[model samples]
Structures are given as C-alpha cells and as structure tokens.
Target: MGKMAAAVGSAATLAAEPGEDAFRKLFRFYRQSRPGTADLGGVIDFSAAHTARGAGPGAPKVVRSQLSVCSVSESDALRAGLQPVSTWRAYGLEGYPGFIFIPNPFLPGYQWHWVKQCLKFYPQKPNVCNLDKHMAREENQDVWEQSKALLRCKEVTKRRPRSLLEKLRWVTLGYHYNWDSKKYSADHYTPFPSDLAFLSEQVAAACGFQGFQAEAGILNYYRLDSTLGIHVDRSELDLSKPLLSFSFGQSAIFLLGGLRRDEAPTAMFMHSGDIMVMSGSSRLLNHAVPRVLPSAQEGNLPLCLGTPLPAALPRDTVVEPCSVEDQQLCASYLKTARVNMTVRQVVATDQDFPVEAAEESERDITKEGICHLEDKITHGKRVRLDPDS
Candidate 1:
C-alpha cells in the first residue's frame, strides 16, 4: 500500500471515539509510582522464561536499562522543593507504559558546561544552508527521482546494490558549513566542545555497542503535517552499526517494522526525553513518522532550560508553555508531532584498510607487481616460533 494510505489506516486504528477513555489508561500508567523502579532484577528472569515458551524471534529483549522520572515536588506545580519522583524502566517499545518520565541523565558538570558554552556562542541568526540543505540538494534529489521511478514501475525488484558496503559514505565536519551563524551545526561526532563526543560515548556504552562513530548528525524539525514515510536509513553508513536515535521536544507516534518494507509491524508513541537504540539484528528495520500533530499554542512540556522559550529559538512558537492545562494539551498534541534527533554511526567503506595487507601493498599485489607479503609474513612467523623454542 502507499505510505499515505497506510498512515491513514494506522491513524484510524488508533483514533479515539467521543467519551472513550483514550488517554486515561495511558496517563494513569505513567502516573503510578512503584518501588524498585530501576530494578530489572526480576523482569529479566521472567522474560527468559517467556522467551523459552515459543516467543517470536522479534520479541523485545532487555538491552541496557536505566530509570528516571519527573521531580514532582521540585516541580513548580505547588511551589515546593524538588521532591523525589518515581523511577521507571526504559525498555524497548514492549516495556514502555503509556507514559514515562525520561530524565536528562547527563552529568551535572558536563551539562552545565555545554549549556554555558551554547549560551556564550549562541547564534544571532539562522544559517540559510546547513547539512540538511546540502544533503537535500545532493542525495535527496537522487532519492526523489528513484522514488518516482519506483512508483512508475509495475513490478519492483528488491535487489541489493553492486557494492553494499561502498554505498555507505561519511561526511566529515570540515565539509559542513553552519549557515545559522551558530557555532554548532547538526553534524554528529564533530571534534568540538568535547561534551557531545562524551555524550555519544555514554549513549553507545549504555546500548552495548562498540566502535560507535558518527560522521554527521541530521537535525530535522517537524511542525504541523510534517511527516516521513516508511523507509530504512540506508545512507552512507555501514549497516552493521546501530542507529541511535534521541527525541526531544513534543512527542509523536513512531511506526517501526521488520526488515521487509511491506511488513506490518508495531507502533509506539515516543515522547520527548525518550531514547531509542536500533541495532544488532534489528539494525535494518523499516521505520517512519506518518504524521505530526499540531502543537498547541500554550501549556506544553518545559524545554531543556525549564522555560517555555529559549533565547535561541528555532520554531515560530513554543508548542506548550508552562501551564497545567498546556501540559495536558501538549501531551494530547504530542500524540501528533515531535522533534527527533537521530544519531547514527556511519562507516566509510572506501577508506577502510584491507584485512590482509596495507593499502599500497594490497594494490601492488592485486596488480601482480609483488608477492603476497601477508602470506610470507605468516609463514616466516610460524617457522621463527619453532626455531626460538
């Protein structure tokens, strides 16, 4: 089915009727406070038993876990000091209840440093052309054309490209120009401020991924009606690496499925402060945002600064200001649109060294201009070991 049709169908399935308790159950689920919140101590044992009983292969697994909830007492709700809030488990979609509070788990020292740096170097104006614009100007044109051609074709063929690994490329920081006059662009793994790199490392460590390296970070803003179709992120990156995604501001429904593009998978409503790590066997899963609900004018979730508006604002208006009513409304509208910052590790296949020999040596060997040095070294090393003994 076409993307729009599928989106419409999904929306219809999730649509609420008049007087029906659509969000009550979900809201209550997140509001409840249970002790041992961080304790996945028992859940793992239960999951193992369940998996043994013919659980589907795609069933969610307990990857790395953490817990944090809203500090209600500290909350200005009643002008009281920040009280201890309930902790919650951050599992994949399966472990998520309707609502959960994800804390900003950055170390206070590092967080304060970055915030100060950003404030000090804040841009006065937006840059006209950024990595997204350049990418849209270059790769997007080809993708658009390919998509059109696919639509025109009567029968589609799912053939792998000639060089699957080579298709993945890397964009270096030096190549990107920040148009917004801001010191920072959306490029991932840039060598600046040291804090971002550290944050990326923490995320990678939490998710049990090794050799995590990101060349560029894509920053996308979704307002009303902004939507991305069901597509896999098969850009210039090694598919072997995981795509680590982080969402902030507002909330939206995330539709995720299996490797096949046509497979009917599951859907989850991802809110702000949520993190999703897609890796391992699920690296190639197809995912997309079908739609973004309009943000309410006021009373939305507080931004990072604990303020409704930041000094360097991007959107025309804040989705939700600090108000109880606005929070509720923002929560409802978040079911529509949210800003998602997805971090991916892109491996540049072309620049990778050959497994057997150095680049120059490999070229010479391939051209029949030299002996296989790796084999000779192996043979020599084997004999030398016996001789030494």
Candidate 2:
C-alpha cells in the first residue's frame, strides 16, 4: 500500500475495532517502543503538507485559517517576540472547530528567550513545582541556579547525579492548579507573569479573541522519553475562553481526540515555537502528547531556533536577549528536554469565585496523575485524571 493508504488503514483499524477505547488504543500505539512494528505514517505533520485520514478521500485535513492581523499592532507583535501577525501561517483541522495551529511564528532568535524563561525564571520560588510537594521550601528555591554548573559540564555520564532541573516535572504559574480537586482555587492565586500575559494576549488577539485574560499557566518539562497521558483541560470556570499552549525544544506527537473516549482521534506533530489555541467547540476536547521525538541534531533543535541573538535587536523589544552563559546552559539542557507552557483563563471577566464548597465538584473528568503519571512500559510518563473519578 502507498504511504497515505497505509496511514488510513492503520487509523481505520482503531475505528474498526468494536467495544474498545479508540483514543486510548491509539495513545498506546504511539507510545509503545516496538521499533520495526510502529508505523508513523498515520501521524499528521502540520509543518508539511499531509493528509488527515478522516477529512475525505485524497483531501488534506488542514485548512488555512484566518487571523485578525489588524487586531495586534506591529509594535506589540515584536515586543512579544513574534513575527508580524500577517506572516503567521494559521490552520484549522477539517473535523475540529475553534482549534488554531500556528507553525513556529516566532521571529529569528526569539524562541531562546522563552526557553530561558521556562528553565531559569519560571521555576524559581513563588512559583510551585512538582518537586515542592516533597522538597522543603529552602531546598528547592532555585532550580536553574542549583543545576546550572552541573548541566553545563561537557562530559555527560549516566552515573552522574541528576540535577534539580532534571528532576523537575511541572511548574504552575498564576492561579496554581490543584491536582486533587481538579479546580483553580481563589486562595491559591499568585501574580501571573506580565511578560507571559502580554504574549498570550497578543497571540489570542491575533487569533480573534479580544481581551483574552491569561489567568493560569502550566509548564510541563519533558525528556526525550517522556509521554503525557490522554486528558482534557476543563478546570477553568470560563470554558468559552481559549487555552493557549506554546512548545519549545524537541517535537512531539499530539493526539486531538473527540468528546467521547470511543471516538478516534487525529494525530499531529507539534514542533518548537509552535502554538495551539483550543477554543469554541474544540476547547474541551481530549488531547495527549504520546511521544517526544529525538531531535535530528542535538546541537540545533526545531531548525528555526537559531543562535541566541541572530540579528540586531528591534528598538525596545520585550523579549530580552539571552546572555552567553544562559544561552549555553539552556541549549545544553534542551538537547535532551522539551518545555511546554499552557496559558489558561480560569474565570470570566464578570464572574467571581463562589464560596469554596464543603465538597469538590465532580464536573471535570481529569485523570489522576495528569502531570506525574508513570507508564508501566516507560520510566517518566504521567497519566491525567478523569472527571468521573
């Protein structure tokens, strides 16, 4: 069979199966490491022209999406380290509404800034991370600083003790998420980073969402072998607002599933600097990062992410240039890692958090261990909690 035909056959098998969770089946298929048996032909590569199986016979599933270029000023876009709004290549899937995918719209050398922030800035104190649950406050104060010297060492050995940065699994910003309750509590709020909020607003505005408030942020740090389990993001009180996700470092296979578990999902590649805005009908759909692919070259990842400062700085650019030392440390760390930051607006503009109920509401079906699920077959996979649980 031809490549396209084979892809369809593989996907069809999942849909063809009776009484099985198609989304889960596909998730397991992509995460499994059976070298010769695994077929990636079914995966959609948005960076390239690829056919989406269920779109139609011989039709590409990705459709050109229009952005509100006029909504964002050129000055604002530059400040956010993004290319002009007019230059962004946005697309929508055939079957998915309110989902927007922009392939690496970052200006040259700009991604370095975001990468540095995720590693060096966001993990600092005042922000909460998975390690905080078990570690003392003083011990986990500076994740990047504590691990910088060790990570910068050239001779990497398996036996070397892992740095604190390496041990980091996830970091929460703004309104910190509660794993047990699966809700954003009013009392658990922190000052959201202004830089990230600005960036999120610009991107959201360009995507046609005016006044999009970025109230919460989750940064998931993934190693090459890492896999994120299937789950939905419904913790936010305002389901109408879009959830913005930004990717850096190595690429990963993203599976966007339907509302029902039995409904099969469409797989796509999310490369560095890529951004996903899930809103409208697509806002609460199930999704997962089944696998993180190794970079084609350890030295240069995502290809578009060049040197720290590839060109002369624009006057008053918001994204500061990375220092030589910081660049080296970030680059070295990224050679084996990927960072994903998802910004969310938890509450509507007019809405206020109601009194904390005596019992947690069971509206969101988040799988337990969403950020820390361990795959039986793999070492660092984390499962998301289901709302029903």
Candidate 2 residue lDDT tens string, 1-389: 47556655766686559877988888877776232333666666667754323242333377888999999998999999898999998889877999999999998788998999999999997887877766788998999889987897764566676688977778888876777777765565678988899999999999999999988998988877677777888878899999999999988888898898888888777899999999999997989887888766554566776656555677777687788889889888888778899999988899877666213433221222345333222344443322211
**Against the correct fold, how does model 1 do in TM-score?**
0.42
| Candidate 1 per-residue lDDT over residues 1-389, each given as its tens digit | 35434433433332233343323222222223122332111112222224222222233443324432332222221111111223323454453222112234321111222222221121111211122222334443233223332233332234522111111111123112222221222332234323334344445544455456654443343443344444555543366666666555554555555665434444454545555667666666665654333334333442442433222322321111233333333333233234444555545445552232122222211112111101112124410000000
Candidate 1 local lDDT, residue 201: 42
Q: In candidate 2, which residue ranges exceed 4 Å CA deviation?
A: 1-4, 33-38, 49-60, 298-300, 310-312, 357-389
Error (Å) of candidate 1 at residue 316 is 33
TM-score of every candidate relative to the true structure: 0.42, 0.89
lDDT for 298 in candidate 2 is 52
Query: What would you estimate as the lDDT of candidate 1?
Result: 0.34
lDDT of residue 147 for candidate 1: 34
Question: Each prediction's Cα RMSD?
Answer: 20.0, 3.9
What is the lDDT for 358 in model 2?
15
